[model samples]
Target: MKAMEWYFPKSREELAELLKEEGALIHAGGTAIKEERIKSAKRVIDISSLPLNYVKKDGNIWHIGATATLNRVIDSLESDHFLVKALKCTATTPLRNRITMGGSVYLSPLWSNLMGPLLALEAEIEVLGRRQGTCKYEELLSDRGKFQGCAVTEVRFPDVKLIGWFDRFARTSTDYSALTVTIALSVEGESIRDAKVVVTGSKKVYDRLSGVEKALQGSRLEDVDVEGISRNVNVEFTDKPAGSGAYLAEVSKVLLCRGLNALGSAR
Candidate 1:
């Protein structure tokens, strides 16, 4: 392994200049870099020196800087942010303190705990650098190539009546979920007026579950049929970490069912 040269840019201007290099990687909380498979990455742009580390409610949207840690996000929000709550279930305290929003978005690894929740939240990302790009939550989860050469400066979400539910199907508490689901529901008179179902931890990363959302939109909680859910829902495992596809499929269905059922019970 070669000794690496680190670049800590104190401003976006400097960071932007550093990105002109061919093999540079953005280092935010540095936890992901701490696990870097490569000894030398041309340059590690230490964004912690930059000014992208704050959370604020601006008008009707929550603007979150990329350097903000998972724990910071959880601590910063007072009102129950379903997305944050779901992410809190991802890792232990110390690990959460280092894993970053920007790092996660860039990595989008197989077992990402934040992806499903972010998908369900309908989050929007603001990127900086040579080329700028904006992608909807679903688009980001679906096509990662769109993010090439982009630096995530901020992520924003509109304020709404957000109800979030998360379930991690794991052998134990600390284990990563074999399958995880995050549900955001907006209901009126026990019928879902708007719903986002983010199912992750399978091979493909996540499913937006538009079909399920459409079915849920006008139906009351009591009318949400579990049998229909088992039949209607479909997600192909892009990468099956857990063995037995059929078994995991059943487990995924059960976890999603319970999560949705919990949302109904809360009403």
Candidate 2:
């Protein structure tokens, strides 16, 4: 086996220069680095020492630094905050302490519990290389290959008031999720002004249920047919150790309806 080369960059400029190296991979919390694909990389850049571990709110926007651990971010949010609800469903406490917000967004594995909520919130990520500006979370997911040289610096989203609910299905509490559902609704008076539905652990990694969102828009929360809307939506899944594709699809629909119902009850 070949020895791996490691780099510890002390500054953003230093990190950018190191990222220019061929096959260079960023290591924040080092949890995802255990993956076979990431383990094979010959060069690793650790960015934990940088001043990126922060969680703060400025006016109406919330900013979370890239190196901030999952627990750290949760500590800064209310118990009912969407991010707090979704992140609490991730790995065990020990692993959650080692999972960084930036790393989760960058890797976006099939079982990631972060991506679904981030997508539903329309979060934006700031990068430090190649694509140096801020880009919507969805854009980064769609064109990830184009930003290989970029290092995720921060994640920011508006502090919009919405009724949020998140749920994940797994055989065990510590097992990877077979399906994760996230729902956020903006309610005005007695109607839903807007809605965002996202599902993770699907064949496509994660997806936004635009059809369901459209159906919920401007509809009275009390009149929503959660079961019908959930059953009619199409979401493909791949067979995994957790469950068969068909089984997971069925589970996802059930969870979706449950999430919608939870949101409606919260209103």
Candidate 3:
């Protein structure tokens, strides 16, 4: 590995200016950066001092600062059960203490424990730099180039009244998941008025199961066959240590059914 220069930016403006240089990368928690080699980056711009660590609730939206560690998010957002579950699933207590939400959102690695839940909640990200603006989480992940000279400033999630559940398949609780599933639904009486299902490690980084959502929407919870509905959901996978693509697809389907069933059947 080559020696890399590091710079600490005290403000977003300074961070943006530093990013203007070629071969520059933003260092949030430094968790992911430590794991991989940024061959193209000669300088690392640290944004931790920019004061992005925070969690605030405003009416219907929850604002999470980019540098907020996973543990901080767990303690700060008390009402988001799914968020709590997902954060707890990530690494161990020590790692969670260092892993920042912005780093995870930007990395979106295969071992991600947060992406699935964030997608299910329909979270939006606020970035600073060339493409400085709020964009859907999926959109940002889809074209990471948009975040090229940028740093994630915050993540926003709606504080809606909905049933949500999250589950991940792994050899052990601490092991990275092969696949993760999250479900959020709005149930009116016994019928589902709206539904959202997100799965990670499915052929793509994130997949929204539209087929499953359409099938469950407007359906009476008790009458819906959760397992049968899950069969209609299709999830592909890339070749990874977890299992073969076929095996992962099957596991994703089973877990999706279980998560959706738990959310739908919840009283």
Candidate 4:
């Protein structure tokens, strides 16, 4: 077996220089750095000491640094925040303490509880290195190859007040979710002004249900057909130990309707 080389860069400039090295991978919380995943990598750059572990609200945007752990981010938000709801259901308390926000977003695994909510929130990811600016989360997922040498610096999202709902399906509470659904809506009076819907653990890893969102937009919350819209959600799932692809698709529809109804009743 080839020995692994590790580099600890305490500053952004130092981290940038290390990123230029061939076959180098960033190690923040180290939760996602499995041996099989890094078998071809000969170098690991540890950026835990960098000044990137922060959570702050600036004006109408919430900024979370790359190295901030899941628990830290959850603590920074309101008890009812969508992110807190989703993140609390992620892994376990011990694991959440070790899973960093950047690592989860950077390598959005099939079971990730973060991606669906982030997509629903239309969050922007800030990176340093090859890509040194903020880009929509969907854009990053679509063209991840272009960010090979990049280091995710921060994730920021609008602080708008939206009714949020999150749900995950797993045999056990601590197990990876077979399917996850997230919904956010802006309601005025009895009408829905805007809506965002997202699902994870699908064949595409994650998907934004634009069709569903469009159907909910400008509709009276009480009149919206949640069940009908959920049944029409176009998504493909891959078979997993928890359930078959067909089974998951059906399950997703049920969860979507339940989540939407829950949000609708919240208003």
Candidate 5:
């Protein structure tokens, strides 16, 4: 094997040019890429100098630069926000400080803690390269090819008030979760207007519980059948650190029930 080449692109235009080369991978925090085999790439494009590190609120939107670290996100959002809860539950302080939001979102790692919350929150991202435009969180995740040769500039999240919940099941606090769940409920008075249940660290990578959401819609908190609705969620998992697919699914239901109960209690 030959030595890998490296380029530092200070601007998006330069970054695009560098990305045109085959086997050229963007380096944000490099946490995910570093762990993978170097044979996967021939060149590395460092984007640290790019102006992509920021966290600002623009009216009803929250703009987070791609290079913003998990720690940065936690600091930017309110303590009660589901995003903050997810980030805080991800890893230990040191690792959390090193993991970049862009890297997390772009890679969409199987053990990702960011995906569930971001998906549930309906976040969008700015991409520059082969795809130079904004894409919905679901679209980007479902079709990763759209992200190839692209640099994720930033992630945009809506500024909305809602009751949220997040849960993760791992052997230890630092261990990769066997399963992760995030729920964001828009409760208008006594009725549940909107509900989103997103789960990751499963065979499907991540999924939104539409069936459960529909069941909860228009239903009062006290009328919710947390156990039955949770059981309806069908999640599959490959060989995971925690347990078998069946075991994880069972655990997921338990977590779902707990999360829903917690959300109801908040009201």
Candidate 6:
């Protein structure tokens, strides 16, 4: 390990200017700057000391600060059963403590436990100093890697009328998931009016699970075609010797079914 310089940015504007200087990684919770070694960063800007670590909810919008730890969000969401289910189904307690939701967005982790639910909920991110504007969650996490040198200010999730269900099939609860499925279902009178299904950890960078969403939309629970559900699914996966596409597809199916059965049927 080498001696690295540290800058403590006390404000969002200060953090933005520091980011413009280059070579420093935005330190949220100080977990990834050392552990993940994101791009061999030498200088670290401690964003934790700033005012970015807050979780606020006002009317229809939930505002989560950039440095807010996952545990904080989990604790807050416990009252909202839907959000609580999503957090509980994410990673284990230890990682959740160190893992800031902002870090997870910028990192755009492959087997991310956060992206699945966040994407389904249509979360929007606010980045400063580089991608210095509010952008859609998918846009921020796009392959262009807009978040490479960016610092997230916060993430905004608008309150919606959908009941969300998140399920991840890990080797174990403590282990990082091999894959995760989040289903935000809009059901009315035993029928799915609309659906947003997001699948993380596929052969591709990330999969939106548009196929499953299409099948369920406007279809009654009993009318959903089981055999044809995955036919048009645009799923892509890297063929790791350990986990093949077939295995992920199977897991996706099982988890999708579970989400649908729980949330899809809920009135």
Q: Write the per-residue lDDT of candidate 6 for residues 1-267, one digit (tens) a residue.
A: 887788998877888888887777777665555555754767878887888788889899999988788789888764554556656665678877888878877876654467777788888889887668888888876754666678878899877677787777666666666777777877787777888888877866568877688878888876676557755665665555447777777767777777666653554
lDDT score, candidate 3: 0.83
* Candidate 5 residue lDDT tens string, 1-267: 778888888888898777677677778787776646567677888888898888999999999998888899899899989889878877678887788888888887756588888898899998888778888978988988867878788899899988899989998887877789899888888999999998888777887889998999999987798988876789888877688888888888899999989877767
lDDT for predicted candidate 5 compared with the true structure: 0.84
Identify the runs in model 2 with alpha carbons over 4 angstroms from their true place: 1-5, 35-42
- Residue pairs with clashing backbones, model 5: none
Every candidate's lDDT:
0.75, 0.87, 0.83, 0.87, 0.84, 0.74
Task: Please report how far candidate 4 places residue 88 from its true position, in Å.
Answer: 0.8
Task: List TM-score per model, in order.
Answer: 0.90, 0.92, 0.92, 0.93, 0.93, 0.87
lDDT string for model 3 (16-78, tens) is 788778768777777787535577678988888988999889988999998999999999876
Tens digit of per-residue lDDT, candidate 1, span 1-267 = 566788888887787788767677777776666555446575677788778888889998888888988788888875467766666776788988888877777676644477777777678887767656565656665666766666887777887776778777776777777778778888777677888887776656667788888888888876788568758877665435454667777777887888878877777
Selected candidate, larger TM-score, 4 vs 6 = 4
Off by over 4 Å in 5: 1-4, 35-41
lDDT of 4 by residue, 34-147 (tens): 788688788989898899999999999999999999999999999998889999988888988999999888887756688888988889998888667889988888888988
The clash tally of candidate 4 reads 0
The better-scoring model by TM-score among 1 and 6 is: 1
Shift in Å, residue 115, candidate 2 = 0.8
